[model samples]
Target: MRKYMVTAILVVFAVVTIGTYYVQASQETPPNYKLTTVQGDASLVEGIAVYGNYMIKDSTFGIKRAYITTNGTDYPDEKSAISQSLNRRPMKTQLDQWIEEHRQFMRGKTNTSGFYENEEMLAYVNATVDTKRSNDSSAKRNAKLSISVLNKQKNNTLEITSDINVDHDISDMYVQNVQLIDQQLVAMVFMNHSASGFVSEPQIIRVNLTTKEIKNEPLALPGVKSVAADGDTQYAWLANQNLEHTDQWILRISRNNHRKAYQVDVKTGQISPLTFQGHEMLLNNIMNAYGQKIYFLQKAVSSKENIGFAVISYDLVSKEYETTLKNTHIDLSENITYAFKQDHLYIMGYKNFKGNRLYVFNLTSGNLEYEGKVISTEAANQAEDEANMDLNFIDLGQF
Candidate 1:
């Protein structure tokens, strides 16, 4: 009887302990465990959206014209859009003027038979000229976005809605992005009223899909540089700098060199500071989140000396930065553009001015998955190695 009682008591205690552990585990759910599956050309995904069984692609940069495409039908067709915000002209500086002058001089000097004697030097000249042109062109902001909804189940009928127009007091204002947040789409616009000012404050336009009501309001924080939104959590990284600085280069360097990140709750409008262990200059841009981890790109302070960058992971629950990927060979500062899709981070850059190469890294294991050439050496020289400038991707839980 004594032996049996002892054995029964031990079994009961074991069951109770196991039960308590499971209850605790259930209460503290791990980061998003949803299996992420990615297909098609990951490089081409600039902005993405999912509706029922369809994936909407919003490819904006590098290309001559930005367009949206739907994958619902067998034959995908590009659709044009009308931007919700006003176009802002680029503010030119002394450096820009110098670049323009130098480019013109190069064109005149290499005008012999439409080519120069030294091919390599000619490529460098052409690349510099292209960079100047891109900088000059990006200043004049054009169309924002025009949305046409489609129902795959309903014979792919495109429902064209009346476009929303932004009220602009100045021409130097443009829409930064139109993103889907919490099943509701909103447009973020940066308005530059001061022709002499370096930085412009941001404005938010909330759109109601059902009612088509547009509410335009100034963002709570003026220093908010960029925002990364997910289904559960929405956060914006703010860079506070002296906007009164006359020179834009100085303003940008200060903004990049000194900045702080914050977590903004969309529901309660509560803001909390995000603390991490690293120099402010290291954190360049915040990429989309995977599960409960927020991933971001960090450029080293002195790129000329190190020529390296890092990938930082910040855990929401722990409120800490988990990992930093910095290798001697990984030259992230040289990258023109980057994208994080599914489980991989893609970086596009030129290899010794040879061609554009795509470097893929697996986020889960924090490993370099693959590296391959995205463009030919000749093409890279011709386009000035800015072919991958259009890289973008929609967040995992955005839709």
Candidate 2:
């Protein structure tokens, strides 16, 4: 009888342990997404903006150009649209004349070093004609904020100009990210801490272009790095760390009620805790892109030498965590990156090396698609070395 009782106890314990293991494993293993890959000529592409059938690539020369191929092998031409629009010049200027005009505009802006800062400083002016008006109704619009009109066709450029009366002090506000919400331009600005080496406190400001007013809101986290807004839902995600420690938190705010700010949505806002063991994670540099779904990137803490990337997607309607990409194959060594138009993400490291390849998760197929290789410092140096050796080689008389 004693032996039988002992045997029965052991069996039950083993069954319980196995069940626990299975539960833990199931939680960790997320469903895979479909992925695909395409190969092309090795061109370092950055800041991909897709509008209609055209894709614009912003390169090192501070110029934005697009490429299209009638035949698969050839991408032969480039044009300067961003430069022309910024200068208030006619987009149809002859090639040589446009080049000279862009050169002059760039020279004046040469002293600016910070990428985001320079872009924010440029004045944006646009003009549009209202055919419905009895007269050839043309109105000029101008503002200190960056503006782009997304029309049905998406390619036509409308013209507008106004001697934008910007409060020069607005430039003093360190604007981090800007987004268009409900046909109104919303900007997130914080304190500039690059020179100080540390951020003590951060602030968030929202500007209503239609009202021409600015509202400043205080952040709950001390070392707030970045802020992103979900225009569709009127919720803002602010990523920041504690002033004394490295712990990070994602604070969600309701734009509708600017007065009440909470860590998570009690009625509606949601907060998630993110931790980085030793390395300092700049919450500001982290990016969030929206489409049919909302996706954001956070650093994963692991015991392994190489801590990989973590991607989280939240379903707006369900109000639950839809999917997570944790410690995946995506490279995390690079400091800054952006999510591409096709829901693909890309990151470029210093000196432009092939740090890691980008793959998109296809929700329907449950697999990952190989998008393309991200330029990193390591890959760039290797390519340079090979090219230099080829140039230095002396041809043998006979091989």
Candidate 3:
């Protein structure tokens, strides 16, 4: 009877321990998003273009690779590539001739894909600033920001139907990124006066697609590194780097780059700064602007060299941020590429010397959704060894 009692007690204790272990495991388990990935080109890739669920990437030597959300190969056929080539080539326009005559006008640059497509229309912003110096140390600067629209025909041809240019008084003007927000073409404009001696400020300009009217609101801070918006909730991260003074800049370059993040009000054009913990926020991994939170990867090291990153969240309502994941043992390369879709943030980078790896995180749960290897080839490895290798985001939506 004594032996039997002892055996029964042991069984009960074992059952309790097992139950506790399983409960903890279930609570800590990550979500299953059914994520999958396939091989892209073995050569280096430049940028990515997305058409709904499908993605198009320009591989080495003009080779294009198209894939869906699953990351499987679905190359765009010859006809589609040929059609896009027309847009890719430099089309000689009056703007090009104007740029040639005026060297200052050439300084005002625009993105290659200032054109963004939605609802069968391609919209772009073309900007040029003219600077005329007076005899005394003063100068007169004038800028023109133009909004152009091209209609897509049933035959996949784009024809320019309308163009309207907005006149503004600014020393230098450039269109950084144009986004279609709330049925309007909103452009993130970088403008400054030459006397100011730096990029003065970042402006949010909204264009009425139908009426060709333009209205703008300026951000409080200069050096806007990145900006993302979703409906009314918008935010911009500022990275104040003096490209002129590389040495003094390098003193605080890594730490000062993303030192501040701000919540932007689309209606009022007002910006309020947010307090966050880490400093080295990776600008490339910033996902699309969600409702009231910004999701991004930040790397904070004890010294100047640690490259490990931590995931963090900034709440637009509270205007504060808390680190969701502590710095992991995983080391990340400076060349990181990322994209956000659904509720997942997908990232790719060199996992130390283990070659390039792709990872995804659940923005809602703050759990790592998936991590896998992106097959690297010999040529890609050689190219990456070069000094100028860079990781470019293939603007999934902008193309």
Candidate 4:
């Protein structure tokens, strides 16, 4: 009888202990885990987002955002968005870095392409329309383009405003780009029909900085016709980077079932078609042009029928293949995220159980330059739960 009483008392004690632990666990929870760079140059992983579909508890999942950087990760949250607070630095976790770098000279910026900055100078373009309404009867509007330039080394500002040379209505025109080549300011724009709501092709406006004289230059695509309103043909003029220093712009004409890239000498007003040596390149595959070469991201397949991916660099002058970046180091089995900037390519391989790995390549040299990985900083006990975590790598943050 005494043994039976002892067994019953022990059972009651076990129940009470479990209930107390459960209450404590429910009251306190740990912070969310973040992904950090394990090894290699942390600069390779900077400015990219590690989107996590993390396993919260048991089979449940939660979404989390963390900005990867070399110094440390910044998890942007509600608290990190308060600007005027006492702790401003801790709260200033914005995604884009463009405004932070060019905010000083970005006044009168009408569009994204209206701003351009280099080591020596900063340039901006603004378009405005002055309307004189005669009792609102189809108001007369005058289009004006303003150029603001700041020379960093000389520490001086030059401002010029010119009336856009357009015979028709330009009230609906917008600035496409603003680039500086020595003393000339180039403003590319598109005019929309106010009545039909149609967007026309890109037009170039040249401003002689020294003379403050403005002139108009047309896009010279000799025989290529525009796509009609009700046609199946889709057309676009691909604008690219490095226009300020290159003294020329690579203009790509893309149409339905056809693609042709052109090298327009901005200074001399010369237009020529860029040649592709072997297989024809599709418009969507053309990444961007830098210097005298164009890059393409195309898929490749081997004799064994194994699928592969390729990044090709074509020399515009020679009309030949310069470099093809296909290395054995890159994982061919999983999905990859890539970004092309200047002469560098940033690639990230997706790994489900193992953390995602980063790969950086030099496009000019066609070499795999650096490698890094994404690691979890969660508790060791949560290893099983973390296996369900899904990380999707978006492109590198735009500068």
Candidate 5:
């Protein structure tokens, strides 16, 4: 009788432990949405993954990890889990976790444009100004160049400072973009004339990482009075909202709406005008560039249930504009996100708890190569899904 009681107690304890574990696992697992191929080769999107922020109605909820593809080549389920609800478990998305694990040193510093990272080191640049003010013209402003670098191999960080000269009227300086060329740190900066809210003057600043010497170079343009910004207005952005390492930067600078495009060589500081005088076609359109061609979305219309736009492309090699997708405009629903990779354009439409669709376009041939829709494998509670309805994709990459 005593032996039987002990056995029964052990069995009950084991069952309770297993049940508790299952409950925790279910809570951690995100809603499963599988991709279903509707046309062409769906496998083309196996390398692309997108991560986004979720908003329920009006407030911030959490983040969605890298997207799941139909094929097994994308982000693994074990690693890519959605982080939901601030009141619940304080978990981070897969993208955030990856950045933390891989580029741990750049956790807080790389938010702006003045930073460069590679497998060996991560570099950052900024300018610091002294509070002392003087009336004499010869007394240059007390400004210092701030540079920081993290060596991944040695697990060491180096901080350097150098004095920089500026006129008395210059009030502030900001680093826009940074590059490391031949052991030298190059930073594109914007200098404000005063504290007033207005456009800034564009300039190039260079610092020797070893010698800690600072040098200033003036950025000059032809015809266009200013090259401060890339046609970005006070409220709108027209260029591709992505970053990549390049030897040349395309700049659109204009006054009184006569916008003209120019390419600047990062190495030689040479400025050459591009033939694309596309002020009408590029205004208020989302554009991304690949190779010598530029793709843009125009005539974007959004309603309660659907969103669509016309696709157009301009070739720098041929100096010609062409309309993609024939006479048909792309029809998507709710929110849309797109990215360029592997000579293909990947676009997705997702909303609420229900599954959505994916469209792939071959950039070289200008044809729709594949279409896929997401299929929900598991049922979700309607109230919970409603609380997590809205989403905004913030990042895209091959995860």
Candidate 6:
């Protein structure tokens, strides 16, 4: 009887311990969503914009107009669009041929080294002669300063033209960065050529669609390269870090009044330096959405080849550093790229060179999971070619 009682007690204790362990593990694990790459191309993805199921990616080849697919079928064929305010002129047959030749030259034999490696050559070529080409001239003339939205379900495209129309003859200014805030398209324009022989400062401009007017808001920093805003706090964060070095600063600007700008500090600042492991960290990007939260990526200050990336989130209400997304084992060098939409944080990463993968993490659930890779490089290349065929279909004269 004594032996049986002891055995029963041991079994009960074991069961209790196992149950406790499982409960703790479940509580600790965050809920994560799955994101499939669906498609990608090797033509140097310049920018990515996400809206509902529609995703627009701009590349050297052209713009890839695609929609998110959950169960394999594309949403629908969405029409490509350009700015409505843009007055497109009829291109002479000679000019059309010239544009085609230039496009082929850019896509084909031109050295990729010109883009990434040699800045001087790229600057000189793109500035002086390339600007005279038909496509380049059209881009300059149109200056499509607003965001273009494609409705996949309806197979329609909507171009939101910039409210501010300035006839200042600003020829070389290119749209460097764009973000959607409360249905308004905010754009950053910078001079294409670096006159300072180092880096150029970008001008922050905001356009109100309802008012149809443009506001020229120069950034507080003279050499500011990028700007990210937290809508909840009505604060805009600008980074002036050179990619080659870690010397950088984040300026907090009041959205209500662009003139009111200050550096982030311990008391009033939303950012915390403690979240980053490295002293030499440079801010790369910032993403903020309503009720979703704001997150930013910082590259290590050091020049070490193996240094990892850090993701920092800030609480808008408390103005405090909330969490640090750090996993040293995960190599995020070229492996990670993120996009924020609604309540979803889409983190696309690859574990190895053989395959491209994507992971979707829910900020609210704290859940992280691998979604799987949808499109391979070879497949992406084919899709890009198909999209380029429609380039001739659009009547530029209607612009």
TM-score of 6: 0.35
Off by over 4 Å in 4: 1-62, 80-104, 108-112, 118-120, 127-143, 165-178, 190-200, 222-228, 231-239, 242-244, 275-277, 282-284, 302-307, 328-336, 349-354, 381-397
Per-residue lDDT over 329-398 for candidate 2, one digit per residue giving the tens place of the 0 to 100 score: 4444444334333354443222222423333443323345434432212343534322211001111111
In terms of TM-score, which candidate is strongest? 4
If both were scored by TM-score, which would come out higher, candidate 1 or candidate 4?
4
RMSD of 4: 10.4
List lDDT for all candidates, in order.
0.39, 0.33, 0.45, 0.58, 0.58, 0.36
lDDT of 5 by residue, 1-399 (tens): 999999999999999888765565445545554456888985675544334332222223334443444531122323434423322111243335436755755565533566676788777787767767677745778788878888878978888878877766467777767777778877777665443223455677877778877788877756543222444321112132223455555555544445555566667778877655754647446566655666766544445344465567877667788766432345564556776664577776556423445677886677789876555455555345334433334233322
- Once all C-alphas are superposed, what RMSD does model 1 give against the true structure? 29.4
Which digits, one per residue and each the tens of the lDDT, describe model 1 over residues 145-177?
A: 233333323423222233333322223444433
lDDT of 6 by residue, 1-399 (tens): 999999999999999888875565444311111124444431111122111221222322223223222222121222224532332222323233323634432332221111211121111011111223233322422344433333334534344444343222233454433334343444445533222122223455554545656565654443233222232223333332211111122343333333222233212123333223342132334534233234665544234654544556654446556445543443455544555433444554433312334444555554553344434123535444222211111111111
Instruction: Give, for candidate 5, the lowest lDDT window spanning 10 residues.
Output: 233-242
Which has the better lDDT: candidate 1, or candidate 6? 1
Q: Which has the better lDDT: candidate 1, or candidate 5?
A: 5
TM-score of each: 0.42, 0.34, 0.48, 0.70, 0.59, 0.35
lDDT of 5: 0.58
- Quote the lDDT for 83 in model 5: 29
Worst 10 residues of 1 by lDDT: 242-251
User: Could you tell which candidate, 1 or 2, scores higher by lDDT?
Assistant: 1
The alpha-carbon lDDT assigned to residue 199 of candidate 4 equals 28
Clashes of 2: 27
Candidate 2 positional error at 338, Å = 6.3
